[model samples]
Target: MNNQDIKAKETTKDSKYIQQHLANERTFLAWIRTAISIIGVGFLVTNLHFTMRSTLSPLGNQLATLIGLVSVAVGIVTIILSAAVYVKKIKDINNQTFRPPVISMIFLGVFIIIISLIFGAYFFII
Candidate 1:
């Protein structure tokens, strides 16, 4: 095969590898939107804390505060890591070495656990 043919094959449009890279980019953008929503939730919760404090029991009030703080913290943390992952993933794709270290997934698991805990606390207390 000619060099042109090899070059074309290396980065073919129909290649699964190319499709996966595109998919990753789309997923990264989706994650960014999710992070923004999370930050918004954090902001709302923290601000709403003042308005709801009078209606909530003592434990409920505290739980709300904890959830607010944790939500913001987790949102910030995930935002940083997600950006890093997205950049690294792009680099990996360019180098044809698209493997993740799995740290982000682990972090995601932890974030889910935190959210679950927050809800569980609210339910148990109320």
Candidate 2:
């Protein structure tokens, strides 16, 4: 058979799971968007702190900077973890052995809780 025929065959094979693959891609993109948003929030917090430095006490300024840096780091971790999950899901999908994500979800939940507590303390106690 010609190259075109072989290419067509491969496409047809992959097309069998096109919907699943598309869904996976959409999920990955969503994760990417979430990461970007988290990063943006981090930068916004840092910038706000810098802009209002004169009004904020030294301790408050330091706390804001720390929170901003932590936010950025969390965002970076989210991206890395999401990419790993995406790749694993892709492989599982192809192999027809997909499993629900557990560890990552738990990790994220804990992170959110910690961050929320930090924000609450910063707002109420600081």
Give the top-scoring candidate (TM-score). Answer: 2
Candidate 2 lDDT score at position 116: 87
Q: Rate the local accuracy (lDDT) of all candidates.
A: 0.75, 0.81
Per-residue lDDT value at 32 in model 1: 81
Q: Write the per-residue lDDT of candidate 2 for residues 1-126, one digit (tens) a residue.
A: 999888767755446688998999999899889989988987887787778756787777777888888888878988898899888887888888998879868977998998888887666634
Q: What is candidate 2's TM-score against the reference? A: 0.86
For residue 57, model 1's alpha carbon misses the true position, in angstroms, by 1.9
Residue 41 local lDDT, model 1: 80
True lDDT of residue 125, candidate 1: 75
Which segments of candidate 1 are over 4 A away from where they belong?
A: 1-21, 44-50, 100-103
Which segments of candidate 2 are over 4 A away from where they belong? 1-3, 11-13
Candidate 1 TM-score to native: 0.68
Estimated TM-score for each candidate: 0.68, 0.86
Predicted structure with the largest lDDT when compared to the true one:
2
Q: Name the lDDT value of residue 68 in candidate 1.
A: 76
Worst 10 residues of 1 by lDDT: 11-20
